[model samples]
Target: MWENKIRCPCSRCSNNKFLCEDKVTEHILNRGFTGAYTIWSLHGEHDVGQSLRSRDRVEPYASNKEHEEYGEPIYDEEIENPYSRMVKDAMGPEVAFNYGCENESRLQRLYMSCKTAEYMTWHVQNQSDDGVLKHPIDGEEILSRLNSLPDLPFGTKCGDQKISGYGVSHNWVKNSILWDLPYWHMLFIRHNLDVMHIEHNVFENIFNTMMDVKGMTKDNLKARQDLKVSCKRPELELMKNNGKIFKLKAAYTLNKEEIKKICAWVKQMRFPDGFASNISRCINEIDYKFYRMKSHDCHIFLQRLLLIVFHDMVPHSIWDAITGISHFFRDLCTTEILVDHMEALQGKICETICKLEKIFPSGFFDSMEHLPIHLPYEAKFGGPIQYRWMYPFERFLQHLKKKVKNRASVEGSICEAYIIEEISSFSSWYFEPAMRTRLNRMPRNDDGGDVDSQGRLSIFIHFGRAFGPLEKSRFLDEDEFYAAELYVLMNSEEMLPYIKMFDEIIKGDVVHISEDELEKVRDARFVKWFKNYVATRMDEIDPRILEISHGPGRMIMSRPDTPLEPVTTVVVS
Candidate 1:
């Protein structure tokens, strides 16, 4: 009876635990299927592929009017004028925006639950006494302002239905739904910024300006025009050349040859596996501009590679400022943050931006540059920037986009695909421990197959899967073959005892030898002496010892493969 039993796929069990056949049927009857398990792979039913005709077929039933009347907006058609509709919808009253419950119900959930009630008053206990800012909750000025401000009356509107002559109340247009909570304003870390996008924007501004890409650069014609009026820099002011207005080359912007050189360097670069994407493809040699760089690519550039590529190429002042900003971001995005250090970082970042302000034009300092000032404060309370970033959500959205098989009915297709994925995920929990699931899949570079666990030499173990095609097989020279054998034996765990024995014999032979000289003697003659020593122990020895004594073979397979290092190549224009 135990041999025939299987895990139940009911809502309660969710394929996580096993149950007897009778109990499983009873559970299913009582609780229904877990994530609607239609594919019964565990019950000897394979997932047969549906015909193309059936898969592509769009089954239509209800109209938009009928959906509205029935109090269901299950299926929404693709918005034709999405931007305009979005703006119009955003401007409408908030009375229709309520989804789960009324304001009273949400407040009750926050205050009534013993677990939640403790969290509501956590700030009062956790707030710091020292002047140093560790978390947002420790912020004195912000908290004082929040506490001082009078709460807006419930249902108060700004411009929609103005009670007084003023369009807004204390610069606030409308009362936020969150303000309904008594403790909303008092809570620390009320708003958090997405550092992923912030990094991308900051990198975009700096890269474009330094490279002086046409139209995209912050050091454009209009910027120079503004520079003339705003600042007293005579060199940067626009001059009328041959009846056409022309801007002089700024000291910060790179020349044509410098841009070409940078682009060429980025093109020929390679990266380690899984480190970053093919950034070389994004480089356009003809135009000398980077294109189609994703957020992660921007992240890689800002955090790691930005300074390396631009170290000595740009002017000294510009490079110094850029390095300061780069180091600031690299430190900010660290997984483990020290609270005591955030106060210093906050001041350092402000100084770094000021240095940038001195070098670059006025237009260079956009909201992205200014946003970093608040980030350290947020990071103080928010912890690591990874939790607040949009990288995971962006990847998940990309995954959802791949699920669009039927583009005509995209919503329907995503829904169906999502349901199927849920079913598979629920069923995967019951799979055997040894079986490969999504979470337990092998990494790209795992090439070591199963080996004898008992008495094998560690030197025979291979790691990092071979990449590219094998070009040819050839025999190594006498010296090359010996070198390989020595390397393997030196690194092998099984050969450690023999190596130590040889070392002791060496120490005895050269009584007055120094440490460095003794190491050289061991490296030079250890292999030959070890081989002869192993041969003497032929009567009772492991097979591995005999094999090592014979040494490695001359023949080896050659392949032209290099690590995809995190780098880019450049083509000279």
Candidate 2:
């Protein structure tokens, strides 16, 4: 008998005996070789010959020349054979193709058999009432049964087996109660099939049944209301307690007086339990003696004492009372002592100046003209004679000018004349004494070196005259005239001592001269006198300027002595 056959060379194909090589080839050639034929021929049967024929036949129909030139053959082994090469030369290489034929074939058979069997069985089973069925219990009947059940024990397994037993009993009870109802038969079947399961069905049935009994719509609304009521009570209570605690702690930490007042307020308030009474008792026990002191000084002393005592401990409530009390006493005592010392120092200053005025009247007053007028002395001017006590004789002029502005006017021309006479007379007195002091203080060869002491007396005596009252002018006009005369006289060796004094004071820090002061010094006519003195002394002592004037290639030599020419060529070369 010639039977209809379909073949797949795959080893796992269900019907091995049904495969036909002839049919497979005819299918490839007629239907055009699909990927299935290529895959089955090569990988399933290892049938290289069939693949080559398909490859050769399909190549001539290639879409382009490049594909024909290097296209893969249906059976790759054919590339080496003469006949295959000739066939390819005459036509073209076939397209090699692969597809999942084995999987498709197996699935097609399975689907056809399963679908046929399902249809037959479905029809046969549906004809009988008990064969295949659906539950007939409506949502209302299931809800009624659930509501009737007593609440399950908390630890009950609620597994499917237990649920199945309950479901059967529940269905019987439902029918007995609703025997005359039209849907009783339907309800019985539904309770058996829909509600019972072998595992984990009890919890699901209970939940679903409860949902139906309550009605999902009402249950959701009730849940929302319950949550709101639960949340509000705790929130309001929390806020009320927090506000009371916040007020109590804030008053306690910041101001002791405020804390006492607040505690009294709490005691008057109608608080729950003994809360107000307890808080008031706690406040009374705390040490608040320091609270009577002023805040600023108390705070400073408290902070300092705390730093000394508890620098290593992290600060907490335990040390606050002790530190505050200590600070109050410390600030009050220290401030009183400071006030007493200041008063005593003021008294001493007033007595000293009176004695100084009597000892050397002219010498002391003349020294006062150049003293610094600081702010404290400025405020005390004329109000009291106390400044004269603190200031030395040299500072008397500053105190007079600042304190008694009329002192200069009071002394008048006679004072100026007297000052001029006194400055000149005092120069001799001050110069010899200063020179002797310098000489006596000088380092000797036995102590260190003779270099520092050799001309020490002469140098210092010269310096003393240049810096002493002689250098300070009594009036503006006199100062200008004296500076001009001094400049000219300074061009000679006789005036060298004054120049040395000017140099010493200019470089020294005793005067604390700023750049502005130096500029003022430079603008003063006395600077010209000092410069001329320096040049004149250098000329007399060294005689090097005369030598430089006659030196070879000297540019200055080109100028005339009387009417000197401006030497335009600065360098001789």
Question: Which candidate comes out best when scored by lDDT?
Answer: 1
Q: How accurate is candidate 1 locally (lDDT)?
A: 0.74
- Among all candidates shown, the one with the greatest TM-score: 1
Model 1: per-residue lDDT, tens digit, 1-573? 247677788998988777897898799899999896776666545554677435535433445556768887655665354445545675786555545785335544554434345565554456565644445444443566556665423221221221333334454434468887665666566777899989999999999888887778898877777886777778878899789998888887888888888888878877787788888899987788899999999999888888887887877778888888899899887765676777789999999999988877786777888999999888776666776689999999999999999989999999999999999876665566577877467866666574656666775544434456666667778887777777877898887888888888888988888989978887789888987777788877688778777866666775456444322211111
lDDT, candidate 2, 1-573, per-residue tens: 126555534334422445465755555456554444433433234455867978968776763555567784544353365544535765666777786565324423322333333433442244323211122111234435555656533221112112224434435333346666545654422322110111112122212221222342122333333434544422212123745521112111224454344445533433222211222232332542222222222233333433243323323432343343333223322311232333443444334334323221122222221121121122121112222223244345654454333554655644665576567654434344345543245533122322434333221222110111212113224444444444444454544565567646675943777778764564464545555555666656434323322222311112211111111111121
| Stretches of model 1 off by over 4 angstroms after superposition | 1-176, 447-462, 472-558, 562-573
Which pairs clash (backbone N, Cα, C closer than 3 Å) in model 2? 55-94, 59-93, 135-190, 349-389, 353-389, 368-397
TM-score of 1: 0.55
TM-scores, all candidates, are 0.55, 0.11
